[model samples]
Target: MNDKTQDIAIVGGGLAGASLALLLSHHLPQLKITLIESFPLFNSDNEKSLPSYDDRSSALSLGSCRILQTLTIWSQLKPYLTAIEKVHVSDRGHPAGTLLDYRELDDISDEEALGYVVENRHLGQVLLSALAQQSNIDTISPATVAEVTPQADEAQLVIRQGDKQQRLAANLIVIADGAHSSLREKLGIAVEKSDYGQVAVIANITSSGYHDGVAYERFTDSGPMALLPLGDFNDEHRSALVWTVDSDREADVVAMSDEAFLQTIQQRFGNRLGFFTRVGKRHIYPLALYKAKEQIRRHIVLMGNAAHAMHPVAGQGFNLALRDCSALVDTLCDATVRGQSPGELDVLNHYLSRQDLDQEKTIGTSHLLTLLFSTAETLPAFARNTGLFGLNFLPGIKAWFARQAMGVAGNRSQIAQPASSTAAEKRIK
Candidate 1:
């Protein structure tokens, strides 16, 4: 174990990388951190116009919300959050809809929400602003990692910053670049990829009736669709929509007039939220599952989409990434206290080991759900409707689904537990 100051460099300052930097900065104040991002940081002024942020909304599991609170950014995000108190899951044209209510959970408090919905841009604004204020973190944005050289004792990153090229040495290098991480490719890490041949079209819609803080998951003939409750827009109830369309039909769906798009959505989603009166800008992304065959190497590790990217069917992608951040922070803090290099293969391995089960559960659950709900086969359709009906009537099964959806199942990490700040302090001490 070395007590000397260690340089930790994180590539990719998107949500995953940025959040990890913030976590390390908070828990291990003595470590010098550098966050490199190719895209310019989002700010209050330009967030509205940012292409990357275009109408995208993220559902924060209770576990993720707890982690954000420990980072002290929850307050800043609260204003933009809309609580998801209930989830209604059903198959399109089906008679029975399954309900997962926060109030139904014996352990969940009546006042607490099952989860929350926030615009990605808003979350990024909070994270980037907080990172800028941290004295220990050096954020280099609008820059790229041209090369990475992992040495016996440390890793060196060749960074291209504007007109200048500079080198940075770090004891640990974290690749959070994204699903299609160039750095991962530079490091020659192979990935297992599965394309679902579906595209997720995202937008916000104002409905005629109040959402009542309910989130809807409807499996239709087209694909899986979700309507997450959102704060009102101009006094009209709003919901963020994630509609999955076949890749072959994505172009036509996106090119449709607003009215036509709304009509199609209403037809697929039904009238649960009343008519969708107004629609916002729509953005589309191809659905895929990508898992880094290797998550840990000598002095490196991958986070977020860099490590694994799952279909958005269950909205577990970012939540699982946040859990990774917490586990990494815990492992690093322990390594630092024990005088061990955080970048050591053993240390990196320990962190990945802790995440294996979580990753498998989340990835498998989302993937299976997508396959089950995306089909229109008579047998699959009958099973889908039967499953929903059974889940609604079976308390144990419904509770299990609810817990997984809220990210409170399995080994609850310290960051996702009650008194997270106190637990974090304990871990550091």
Candidate 2:
């Protein structure tokens, strides 16, 4: 490969794109990288121009934390990391309620938390900060896409960064934009979208009681609500809330205030997490499941939310996206080692084949669980709660569920690296 031609184009400056740039740079320092963002540049402190991640936060699995730590970016956002030592789940008003302590799982260690919660801003900033350390990465913003015409060997991208536009060619183009990615649609890519008729009302609340690193998820007839702890932010006990409400309830949630919202919050949320004291700003997003028809198309590939955007009930979007990041990076890095064109069909499909099982299992399971729980009828509720309560009596079954949640139940060989930091331990397949 010519040094000048060994460049990859990343179309998105979100967490997924920035992480991909850092990983590629870490593995192949000689390759050139061009990262583009449609949003204009601005300081993080400019509230007037800032976009709100709202009360929204992401829970990163241990596997995800491992990836970020390997890139040396975890320390940048450590202050914001809320380790989830245990997850308490229950069905309000039902006979059976379930709370899962990580200690029950023999596979998971006692010291390691189940996951870590970090706001999106923290993730983006940390990723961008890590990108600055890479000499080969060229980050650009306010970029307009002129064209994305796929060629036999490479996909040509004409990106207008500012006044001057450059005709850049990349061996591979990775798309990490959200569910409604215009670029993916423009490229004639097909996608499967399912509307759940649900809205996720999110907010951050200051709780009077300490969470003690416990993340709570309760499912009521309305929908699934998650109370994720925020690690002692500003000397206050905080937990991010994501409540999935039906279309009819969305209007009321949007109009609620700190005082009025607390009333409803207390109704479902028992005294377990202490009093609901104060609430920060709130935001809402419609829930939907989207999966791209194909993982790879010629020289173009979609990762992150662009590939599959699931309902937040499972908190698997970013985790699944990170798996994509690792798989793609490994594939390209291994191709480089073998002196083969990374964008070749054989090479790209090899990566896709390794990821297909995991991709289908997570997305399908997400949709399936959503359908099963959202049932409003009493009979369905009885059956589901029976299962939840039954697991409490049987420690064996609880361990199985715990392992599944930890991403160790299935054959995760595609995303699992050997227990070593040496580059040679990384798997090509």
For 1-429, candidate 2 gives per-residue lDDT tens digits of: 112343688888666777778878876777888887776433454342113232369988766766666666666778878898889888888767787765555444443567789987776666766776678988767676666778998988777766777777788888876688778888888999999999988888898899988899888778888999887767889998988889888888888877999878888778888899898888889999999897687778888888889988888887878877887888887888899766677888988997888888888878877886786688778877888888889877776666556554454443344235432122110
Name the best candidate (by TM-score). 1
Best by lDDT: 1
Candidate 1 on 57-127: residue-level lDDT in tens? 99998878878888778788899999998899988877868888776666555445789999987887788
Q: RMSD of each candidate?
A: 4.2, 4.0
Backbone clash pairs in model 1 (N, Cα, C under 3 Å; residues 3+ apart or in different chains), count: 3
Off by over 4 Å in 2: 1-6, 45-55, 162-164, 413-415, 418-429
Clashing pairs in 2: none
Model 1 TM-score, all chains together:
0.94
Q: Which segments of model 1 are wrong by more than 4 Å?
A: 1-6, 42-52, 420-429
